[model samples]
Target: MPYQWPTLTNWLEQIAQPFYQQGYVILEQAIPADLCWALYQDVQHQQLTAAGVGRQGQHQLNQQVRRDHTAWLNQNNPVQQQYLQQMAQLQQDMNRRCFLGLIDFEAHYARYQQGDFYQKHLDAFVGRSNRVLSTVCYLNTLEQGGELLIYNEQDQLISRVQPNAGTLVIFESCRFPHEVLPATTTRYSIAGWFRQNSSIQGRIDPPQ
Candidate 1:
């Protein structure tokens, strides 16, 4: 049987309400299980490069900050297209309900091997970037380690998320600082951002 992705209407309330009250929301089994499995398989076959910090001119591989491999999601692949489509629906709903004015979303498959970790960081800074919302969709479960730690603006720990297949997390990009703790086993997930168009000087900003 083919996997039928759930429409945003089915889960929008769960996402929108918390996001409205706080700055983030986390949901389990957010995507179809079969779809998550397919995406996991797709990533296994991809050629991933060591991920870097910063963007464009400032981008550089800094293992001290992060240690992971990543491959940008390609819309050409059917499995990836399905996932992207789901995110597209999310983007639309976010704009409609939250007035985020999100114009686009970009994502990449991320793999964290044993002992890999990402240092605490913010996805975007006010007035410095277009990213408005940050997202993470887990494709595989882990027994231990590989927890995502989210912090409040005051630098207090708030949420500790254990990687679980089909879990999705969304948060305001500039309001939260988060990090991936060292993985005891391999971890697979998709990290993404919703952005508003920040075109300037007659040139469109490039996607990362």
Candidate 2:
């Protein structure tokens, strides 16, 4: 069965609690399980290598794609397009509520299988305004491991997000540092950044 989105206002209220208290929130069963699998299949078909060293000191394989209003609308698949639209709305709503101006979404795929995990690190680049929110939609759940570990400023474990397909987890882009535990099974997710300004896409600014 497809997961129905809560009333926009209701979801907003519910999400805000976690956002402020824990620095992250997870919407369980946010997406349809079947659709999640289909999307994962599509990503596998697209199959890009997990190149590049992440600041977290771990390797990651991702496919980053840029899409705006019109371009995303032209996509052929209804389900896929709906997903994108919802994501767009999510970004817009968050921006407005946070008193941040218009922002862009940088879409991408993140896959971690057995032996693959990302080290703990913040999402925002040093000087870039491109990452304001860290949003991840899980495509498939793992039977074991692959939980997202979030730590406090003192480097103490604060909270852990277990791998659950169809779940959407949101958090501040740079505030919380997190990492993925080694996956016992394959974990698929659509991970992306929501920025405050669309003018400059990626890349954070350097420290002064």
Candidate 3:
């Protein structure tokens, strides 16, 4: 017998209530172990570049703020496609259950080497961005370090998440301020955002 992966329905059912009540949710073993393993393998061969802060023209490297390498996820790779498909299903579910009006999702593979960290930051600002929900899926486990710290509106810590394989974290992009703590060992994860189309005057507000 082969290992059975959880269905999209299962994930949808698990996500709704907690997310509605708290604006965020963390799920352990959210993805299939085999799929995570495959993605991790794919990441090893990717040409990762130093991640930047801010968007488009404002984007620039700032090692003081973050020190991770990243590569955007695309459909051409079968492994990445599988993960994207899962996220697509999640986007539909979020729209139906929460009326989020999500139009699409974008993601990237992030690699955090030892001592790498990302300072606290919000994924989006109200009325300034189209990103509605942010998601993080861990592809590799870490015994220590690389914990994700999520803060509430009062700037108080609410959750400390360990970077465990197959764990998924989803939160309202503009409501939470979060950061990645330095890792004692290498860490791997996928960070993604669900967006609502905010086109104006026949132009994409934020070009993909």
Candidate 4:
């Protein structure tokens, strides 16, 4: 089925309320499983630069996954183009409903194989302002050992989200200390952030 905009908008509103109160929300079966897999392949085939430091363990993916990924927002093939547009519209509605100003969706594909992981870190800090939210939609289900762990500032495990193809994980961009658990098999995800124009948005500093 094609991505349904009106239905998605309603779903976003339902999820956004709790997100505002608790700082995160999860939507199950939010996107088509097959389309998500296709986009993952397209990203894997594209040239990827290394995403060092910001990542951990042995993460590997093509160029789109490595650099600032918003540049490829419009490069999808026709069918995938529809999916991308729906995502963009959903993002816009989410921002308006949440009263978070304007939100820009910067999509990224992450590929992690055996022992690959991303160290615990916040989504946006330096060089970006108004980054109020972070979202990740799983492309496929993994065999084992890959989990999205959300932590508080004091390092308490607030939530642990296992991969469910088509489900979306939404959270505050600044408060969560999150990381990808080491992957036993290859894992794919579309990871991105929503940012506003904060005058105090600091310069991009490497994770300490």
Clash counts per candidate, in order, are: 0, 5, 0, 11
On a 0 to 1 TM-score scale, where does candidate 2 land against the true structure? Answer: 0.74
TM per prediction: 0.94, 0.74, 0.94, 0.75
Candidate 3: the clashing residue pairs are: none
| lDDT to native, each model | 0.91, 0.65, 0.91, 0.67
In the range 1-208, model 4's lDDT, one tens digit per residue, is 3232223436656676888788898887777555665666666675544464433344345433222222233444664475667567667777677777644555556676676777677876645445667888876777577799999878899988988777789888888889888878877777766666555464342221
Candidate 4: stretches off by over 4 Å: 1-9, 54-80, 126-128, 199-208
RMSD, model 4, all Cα superposed? 6.1
For model 3, residues 76-188, the per-residue Cα lDDT tens digits are 99999999999998999899999998988999999999999999999998988888999999988899999999999999999999998889999999999999999999999
Order the numbered candidates by TM-score, best leading.
3, 1, 4, 2
Tens-place lDDT per residue, model 1, 109-168, is 999999999999999888788888999999989989999999999999999999998899
lDDT for each residue of candidate 2 in 136-168, tens digit (9 for 90 to 100): 788776778888888777889877888887788
Best by TM-score: 3
Worst 10 residues of 3 by lDDT: 1-10
Candidate 3, residue 149: how far the Cα is off, in Å = 0.1
Task: Name the TM-score of candidate 1.
Answer: 0.94
Error of 2 at 172 (Å): 0.9
Better of 2 and 3 by TM-score: 3
